[model samples]
Target: MEWEAPALVLSATPYGEGSAIVHVLTGEYGLYHGLARGGSSRRGRPVWQTGNLVRARWSARLSEQLGGMTAETVHASGARLLDHPLPLAMLASLCALADGSLPEREPHPAIFQGLTSLLARISLDPQWAVDAAMPEIVRWELLLLSELGFGLDLGQCALGGGQDDLAWVSPRTGRAVSDARAGEWRARLLPLPAFVLHPEQTGTPGDWYDGLCLSGHFLRRDAFGQRHRPLPEARIRLADRIARLADVVPPDEATGENSPQPD
Candidate 1:
C-alpha cells in the first residue's frame, strides 16, 4: 500500500543509528507510524520534529506492515516556536495527546482539523498565543475525547437540572452537573467551567485549568486507561504549565483532584 498526503508530524523517535520511527496524523489516515531513514541526522532532524506540517509519502508491501516514509517540510512549526516556550509546550502536548490516543489507520478528520487550527493559533504573538491557545488546547482535547468515542455531554446536567449554570462534570459519566444538583457530591465532581459551556466568553486562567482538569479526567480514564496506558507526559506538563499560570497546583493526573489556587 502507498499514499502521499499532507501530514502533521506527531512525533519522531530515534531508532537504530540515524533512522527514526516517525508518527504522523493525516486527515484521511488517522495516525501512522513508519520508518524514516536519516530522520535523526543533523540535516534531517527538523523535518520530523513534532508539530511540523509536512508533505509525506509512505509505502509498504502490506497494509499492516511498517512502511518506508519520506517527507518535505511545509511549515516548520517546531523551529518557528523554538523561542516561544508556551506555544512550543502547547504544540508538544497537543502532538503527544494525538499520538497516544488516536487509533492508527482510521480517519478522524475533526480531530485533525482541531489540531491544525490550534497550531495556527499558536503562531500568533507569544502572549496572545498563550492566552488564546490555552482554551483552544483544552477544546482540542475535548474534541479528541469525542473522536475517541468518549464524548462529554455538556448539554445539560446529568441530574436533569437543565443546562443553565452547568458548573461541574461527573468524572465517571462525562456529563454536566449544575451546581444545585451537585449538592453534597460537588467536591467529588470535576469543574465545568462557564466558558466551556459558553465558548463565546473568555476563560480566565482558572477556567482554563478547570477545563484541562475536566477533560483530562476522561482522557485518562476512557482513552488511555482502557488500553492500560497512562496519560502522556507532555499532557501532564501542559496541565502543570496552565496550573502555574492560574496560581493553582496542578491536578494530580491519577487522582484528578482539582486543587484550589493559593489563597
Candidate 2:
C-alpha cells in the first residue's frame, strides 16, 4: 500500500548505518512511523528535524507494516525558529505532546490544523515570542485535551447552572465550577481562566498560566495518569517557563484565591 500526505516530523532516530526511523503527524494518517533510508545523511538530516513540515510518501507491501518513507521539505518550521529559544521550546513541546499522547494511525484533523496554525503564526512574525506565542501554545494544549476526549466544560458551572463567576474546574471530573458553587470546595479545583472559557477575552499572562494549569491538570490526571506515564518533560519545562514569564504562582503552589486573575 502507498499513500502521500502533508506531515509534520515529530521525531527521527537512527536505525541502520545511514537509515532512520521517522515519526510524523499527518492530517489524514495521524501519527505514523516509517523507515527513512539515508535519513541520517547530511542531505536528509534537515528534512527530518522535529517540527518541520514535509510532503511524505509511505509505501509498504502490507498496510499494517511499518513502511518506507521518502519526503521532500514543504516548510522548514524548525529551521526558522532555531534562533528563538522560547518559540523553539514551544514548538518542541508541542511536537513532543502530540508524539507522546496520540495513538498511532488515528486521524485527528483538528490537532493537525491547530499545529499548522501555530507554526504559521510563529513563522509570520519574528517577534511572536513576545506577543502571541505563549497564549497560542496554551490554547493549543487545551485543544489537544479536547481532541483526546479529555476536554473541560467551561461554558457553565458543573455544580450549578450559572455561567457567570465560573472560576474553577473540578480536578476529578474535568468540569467547570462557579465561584458560588465552589465556595468551600474551591481549594481543590483547578483555576479556569476566563480566556479559556471565552477566547474572545484578551487574557493577561497570569491568565495564560492559569489556563495551562487547568489544561495540565486533566492532561496529567486523564491522559498520562491513565497510561502510567508522566507528562512529557518538554511540557513540564514549558509550563515552568510560562509560570516565570507570567509571574504567577505555579500550579503546584496555586490555590483558589491565588490563582492568576484575568485581564
Candidate 3:
C-alpha cells in the first residue's frame, strides 16, 4: 500500500547510520511514522525539519507496516524560523504537540489545513513572521482541542446565556463567562483573550500571552492529562518564552493569588 500527500514534518529522530524515524501529519492519512532512508544526511536533513511543508510519498508491503518515506521539500519553513526565537519556539511546540497528541492514522483535515495555513503565513513573511504566526498558534490549539472533543464554548456565557462581553473561560467547564456573571469568580477563571473573541484584529504581545494561557490550560487538562501524560516540555518552554517576551505571568507559575495551575 502507498500514498502521496502534502505533509508537515512533525519530527525526525535519527535512528541509524543515515536513516531517521520520521513522523509527518497529512490531511488524508493523519499522523504517520515512517523510516526515511538517508534522512539524516546533509542533502536530506533540511527536508525533514519539524515545520517544513513537504510533498511526501510513503509505501510499505502492508497498510499497517512502518513504511519507507521519501519527501521533496515544498517549503523549507523550519530552517527560516531558526533565526527568530519566538517563531522557532512556536514551530517547535506546534510540532511537538501535534506529534504527541493527535491519534495516529485518523484523518483530521481541518487541523492539517490550519497547520498548513500558519506555516505558509510565517514562512512567507520575510520580516513579520513572528507577527504572522503568533495569533494563529494560539487559535490552532483551540481548534486542536475542539477536534479532539474538548471544544471550548466561547460563543455565549455559561452563566448568563449572553452572547456579548465574554470575559473569562471557566477552566472547569471549557465555557465562556461574562464579566457581570463572573463577579467574585473573576480571579479564578481564565482570561478569554480579546483576539480570540475578535479574530479580525491582531493582538498585542500581551493579549497573545493571555491567549496561550487560556488554551494551554485545557490542552494540558483534557488533551494530555487524560492520556496520563503531561503537556510537552516544548509547549511549557513556549509559554515561558512568550511570557517573558510579553512581560506577563507564565501560565504554570506558582503565585500567591492562586494555587499553581497544574495540568
Candidate 4:
C-alpha cells in the first residue's frame, strides 16, 4: 500500500548506521513510524528534526508493516525555535508527550491541527511562546483524556449543582467542585486555577502555570499512572527560561495565585 500526506516530524531515531526511524504526526494517519532510507545524513537531518513539516510518501508490502517514507520538506519550523531556549523546551515537551501517549497509526485530526497551530504560533511570537502554548497544551491533554474515556467535567461543580467559583478539582473523579461544596473536603481537592476554569478571568504568568499544574497532575496521575514519569526536563527548563523573561516566579508559581490577573 502507498499513500502521501502532510506530516510533522515528532521524532527521529537512528535505525542502523545512516538510516532513521521517523515518527510523524500526519493529518490523516495520526502518529506513524516509518523508516527513512538515509535520514541520518546531512541533507535528511534537517527534514527529520522534531517540528519539521514535510510532505511524506509511504509504501509497504502490507498496510500493517513498518513502511518506508520519502519525505520532502514543506517547512523547517523546528530549526527556527532552536535560538530560543524556552520555546525549544516547550517544543521538546510537546514532541515527547505526543510520542509517548498517542496511539500509533491512529488518526488524531484535532491534535494534528493543534500541533501545527502551535508550531506556527511559536515561530511568530517567540517572546510569548510558552505563554501561548500552555493553554493549547492543556486543551490537548483534556481532549486526550476525553478520548481515553476519563473526561473531566470542567464547566461547573460536579457535586454542588452551582457554578464553580473557586473550582477544586477532585483527582479521583476528575470533576470540578465549588468552594461551598468543598467545605469539609477542601484539603482533599486540588486548586483549580482560574485560567483553566476561566482563562479570560486569570491573565498572568501564574494563571498559565496553574493551568499546567492542573492539567499535568491529571495527565500523570490518571492518564499516565503513578510511576511518576517526569515531564521531559526540556519542558521544565523552557518554562523556567520563559518565566524569567516575564519577570514572574518560576513556572510552578506562574500556575499558582499570580497568573496574569484578569483584566
Candidate 5:
C-alpha cells in the first residue's frame, strides 16, 4: 500500500546507521511511523526535525507492514524557532503530546488544524514567549483531550445544570460544578476558569493556569494514565514556566498587553 499526505514532523529517531524512524501527524493519516533512508544524514536532517511541515509519501509491500517514507520539507518550523526557547519549547511540547497521546492512523483533522494554527502563531513572533504562547497552548490541550474522547462538559454545572456561577470541575466525571453545589466537595474539585466555558472571554494568567490544571488532571487520569506513561517533561516545563510568569504578571494585565492574540 502507498499513500501521500502533508504532515508535521512529530519525532525522528535514528534507526540504524543512516536510516531513521520518523513519526508524523497528517491531516488524514493521524499519527504514523515510517522508516526513512538517509534521514540521519546531514542532507536529510532538516527534513526530519520536529515541528517541520513536510510532504510525505509512504510505501509498503503489504497493508500492515511498517512502511518506508520519502519526505521533502515544506516549512522549517524547528529551524526558525531555534533561538526562541519558550515558543520552541511550546512547539516541542505540542509535537510530543501528539506523538504520545493520539492513536495511529486515525484521522484527527481538528487537532491537526489546531496544531498548525498554534505553530503559525509562534512562528510569526518567536519572542512572544510564555505570555503570548500559553493561552493558545492551554486551549489546544483542552481540544486534544476532547478529540481523545475525554472532553470536559463545561457549558453548565454537571449536577445542577446551571450555567451561571460555575466554579469547579469534577475530576471524576470531567464536568463543570457550580459553586453553590460545590460547597463542601469544593476542596476535592478542580477550579474551573470562566474562560474555559466561555472561550470568547479574556483570561488572566491564573485563569490560564487553572485551565491547564483542570485539563492536566484529565489528561493524566484519562489519557496518559491509561497508557501508564507520565506527561512529557516538555509539557511540564511549559506549565511551570507559565505558572512562574503568572506570579509576575498581574491578573488583569495577563490577558491584555502581555498576552498574544487568541489563536
Candidate 6:
C-alpha cells in the first residue's frame, strides 16, 4: 500500500545508526508510525523534529506492517515556539497525551483541530498566549474526555431544581451538582468552575487550577486506570509556569476569574 498525506510530527526515535522511527498524526492515516530512512542523517534531521509539519509518502506491502516513509517539511512550528517554554510545554504535553492514549489509525478530527489551534495560539505572542490558551486547553481536555466516553454533562444539576448556582461536578458521572444538593458530599466533589459550563464566561479562567486538577484526576483514573503511568513532564512544566506567574499576578485575575490584561 502507498499513500501521501500531511502530518504533524508526534515523535522520533533513533532506529539504528542513521535511520529513525517517526510517529506522525496524518490527516488521512491518523496517528501512525513509519521508518524514516536516513532520518538521523543531516538532510532528514531538520524535518523530523517533533512539532514540525510535513508532507509524507508511505509505502508498505502489507497494511499492518511498519511502513517506510519519505517526508519533507511543510511547516516548522518549533522555531517560533522555541523561546516560549510554557507554550512549548503545552504542545509537548498535548502530543504526549495524544500519542500515549489515542489508538493508532483512528481518526480524531476534533482533537487534531484542537492541537493545531493551540499550537497556533502559542506561537502568536507570549504576553497573551497563556491567557488565550488556557480556556482553549480546557476545551481540548473536555474533548479528549468526551472521546474516551467520560464527557462531563454541564447542563442542569442532577439533584437540584435551582439552576442559579451550579458550582461543583460529580467526578463519578461527569456532571454538575448544585451547592444546595451537594450537602455533605460536597467535599468529595470536583469543583467545576462556573466559567466552564457558562457560555457567557467562555474565556474566564476562574478556578483554572481546580479545573485542571479535576480533569487530570478523572483523566488519569478513568482513562489510564490501574496503570503506573506518570503524568507527562511537559504537563508538569506547564503547571509550574502557571504557578510561577500566579505569584506575581493577582491570583484571581491570573486564574482567569477576572478580566485579562492586554498582552
lDDT of each: 0.84, 0.81, 0.84, 0.72, 0.80, 0.71
Error of model 2, residue 216, in angstroms: 1.1
lDDT of 5 by residue, 1-263 (tens): 99999999999999899899999999988888999999999888999999988999999998788899999998889898887887888898889889999999999999999998788778767866444566677788889999998888888888889898999978777788889999878777878877766667657877777766776777766677688877777777666666775674322112211221111
- Stretches off by above 4 angstroms in model 1 are 253-263
Question: RMSD in angstroms, candidate 2?
Answer: 4.2
TM-score of each model, paired residue for residue = 0.94, 0.91, 0.93, 0.84, 0.89, 0.84
Candidate 2: deviation at residue 13, Å? 1.6
lDDT of 5 at 19: 90
Model 5 scores what on Cα lDDT?
A: 0.80
Tell me the spans in candidate 3 whose CA falls farther than 4 Å from its real position.
253-263
Local accuracy of candidate 3 as per-residue lDDT tens digits, 1-263? 99999999999999899999999999999999999999998887999988999999999999989999999999998887677777777778888889988999999999999988887777667356566466778889999999999999999999889998898988788889998899888878888877887877778878878888888888887787788777888888888877787887775521111323424
Predict model 4's lDDT versus the native: 0.72
- Tens-digit lDDT track for model 1 on 1-263? 99999899999999999999999999988789999999999977999989999999999999989999999998888887889887888889889889998889999999888888778668645577776777777777888888888999999888985978788888767789998889988878888877776678778888888888888888888888788888888888778888888998777642334433211
Candidate 4, residues 77-118: lDDT per residue as tens digits? 778887887677777867776776678988888778878888
Please identify model 4 stretches exceeding 4 Å from their true place: 199-202, 226-263
What is the Cα-based lDDT of residue 246 in candidate 2? 89
Per-residue lDDT of model 2, residues 1-263, tens digit only: 98899999998999889899999999998999999999999988999988888999999999999999999999898888888877877888889889888899999999999998887677657586556676677788888888888887777888878889988888777778888888878777777777776666757778877877877777776666677777778777777777888886567522112333322
* lDDT score for residue 47 of model 2: 94
**Which candidate has the highest TM-score of all?**
1
Of 2 and 4, the candidate ahead on TM-score is 2
Worst 10 residues of 1 by lDDT: 254-263
